[model samples]
Target: MNQPTHPAGGDVQPQDPPAAYPPYQPPAMPPRPCGIKTWQIVSITIAGAVVAIVVIIIGVIALSGSMNRVAKEAKDYYDSKAEPYTNPAERKTYTNDTISFGYPSSLQEMSLEGWNYTVRKGTVSDRRVFGDKDMNYFVVYTQIKDDGHPAGMSKLQMKSEMSSLFDQAQSSGSGLTDVLRHEQLICQKHESNDFSDLTASTGEIADGTPVVSFHYVCDSRVENEDSKIETYQSTWYDHKGRLNTITVSANAKAKNKYGRDSINIPGLTARLR
Candidate 1:
């Protein structure tokens, strides 16, 4: 159908000329995929978890094994160190005849578990004990006993007589009983029949008296070792040229996990010289 045309400048203006046709254009779209999908992300997370678990488990096992090794090594070291002290056969060289040093007839010849005795002059006899825990020895002057009666007597009989005499001497006017009790703390609970036979030195005390010292362990209840130490000094001397040893043993276990030697020795010069 034909339609009337209107002037371009008309007030109502003719309907806008038909819109000029434009070239066809495609709709906007996102870039093609270059990243992980949801499933891929989940798979990566699962793989990381498995690797982490394996590493943790391996680390724990390694640490446990290391601790066990350290414990075993420590046990072995202590066992080896305790071996020498436990063996009774290990003997220390010593003079059997204490008389050579001008000790009194009351002194005796005896052998201990860890000592070697070489008698020079006086005859030695061994004393019997209720158990092997105690070391009891008696040394008697055979030259003074006269008339063959004393000489003919058996060692056991001589020891018995000498022991009686010693008991009497200890209990007699001499203050041996008080000395023993006073020195009890030095020995803890153990007592020795002979103090002269022990090793002696000049310790820290100002007194020039000879100092005797030894090492011992408490009954198993305290520790399974000979870890205690003791020291004694000459308290009194008799007109008869006798020395009464007053002694004490000190303990370091209160401060130490194991124990320390009773004597704080600086060097062999002090001990040997």
Candidate 2:
């Protein structure tokens, strides 16, 4: 190669600077989608939830069967250990006799001097014998026994008996003649349903005898005011299957000739439980 001559002042012009080279750069690739990883996570979460639900349902079905078995076993155990109230034959006889005549063997003797209570056999020929030609009325008394000792008589029974009396009152004319004839019609129909939803309860009687004295509502609706009346009732019972006291009363609005008067039981409070 021939050497080039330099100018007297300096070396030959510097060789042209090497042509400028472009900066080094890495190759570019297309960007990935935004949520590919997110979609994968969601799909896995949904699959896990479905599996968990199936497991829980299976567990509940199994548990239900076990619960049913437990309930049946408990019922069977209780039934097996239960005791009877009384012998079947004796019970049937007692129920029949008591319901028929208000006579319970548990009560040795019962008497209500002013109650106008009576028992008569055969059907009542005349309706409205008890002053309820339009409405049904009856009165019944049943003795409840707790150990040869009487617990208390049911006031419900008195309501039933009175209903019977009302029916008897319908047919016969009032006065001494009708009063004498009242004893024979105990269960005559003109059926009445009297209930005493206990409004107030008085404490037990002094005799340590169980007594349920309460105020009740009497639902008596007869056509004629003179014939039959209905309103509030207060009843008392002793432990001897005898009704110790009874008062049929009414509010100011129930203005019937027969108003508030305590029934005359003479000395019934003496017989407490």
Candidate 3:
């Protein structure tokens, strides 16, 4: 090493600091595209959540209405299929000159010990008074002992008598439900049914005899504007010249709305033997 004289006679000329060393750096990695930003992804998720909530609410409302309609339909179906108003446990047997059958004990014997409401020749010998919890009731009259028409009444007259007797008391209402409510009816032709036989004169045939029956409906609106309906049905039959009569009544509104029909036609006829 050759010793060199400093310029200006001092170390000021020591020289520029050593060239700056290059800055250190880590090794590079593979380049990648930026994915969705955090903020954008969060916003998208929140919007989706809101949309899902809205859909759930709409679905709930629709489901609720459908459930209500289904429930109502089920109730109406069951009501239509239910049994009649008569109590089945209390059965009573009765003997009549022309026929015999059982009836619900809930019916009260109408004629008393002294009062004999007798229509000669099965006109109206024995009767039972029956009503429902609503005080709606019916009367069953049968001929016993005195078989055949009244002494002087002809067969045609007797048949007419049986046919028209119970009908006179029937009243009019919405759909003709009330018995005492009097309204013109849309009468149907007498037809054979499970409960009664068909005949030329009327609806009833008793022990092969041509009896009489009339089934008609009254206009429910004729009675009360708000009343739904009033139902009235009657049947008459004869045995050995004796008569068997049955009357049934119902309130249509009460029955459909509250399932409270008090009439039981099948029960009354079941007693016929």
**Candidate 2 structure quality by residue, lDDT tens digits, 1-273:** 998777799766666667688778888977977766888999999999999999999999989999999999998898666432332112111122212111111112223332343323322111221111122222223332332223444545534433443444333334212222322222122222332342333333333333333333333332333333332222333334433322222322333222233111111233422
Model 1, 165-247: lDDT tens digits are: 34543443343333332233233343444332343222322222222222233322123234443332322221122322322
Q: What lDDT does the true structure give each of the candidates?
A: 0.34, 0.35, 0.44
Give the lDDT ranking, best first: 3, 2, 1
lDDT of 3 by residue, 1-273 (tens): 998666675565445667688778888987887888999999999999999999999999999999999999999898666545555356566654554445455554543332234333334455554433332233344344365344444456656755565344332213222222112221121121211211213444334333434443332322332333334444454433445555443446434433443444343322223
lDDT of 1 at 38: 100
**Stretches of candidate 3 above 4 Å error?**
1-95, 100-123, 137-139, 142-201, 204-206, 216-237, 253-264, 267-273
Q: List the residue pairs that clash in candidate 1.
A: 108-138, 108-139, 186-248, 186-249, 217-226, 232-247
What TM-score does structure 3 among the candidates reach?
0.33
Best by lDDT: 3
Q: How accurate is candidate 3 locally (lDDT)?
A: 0.44
Winner on TM-score (1 vs 3): 3
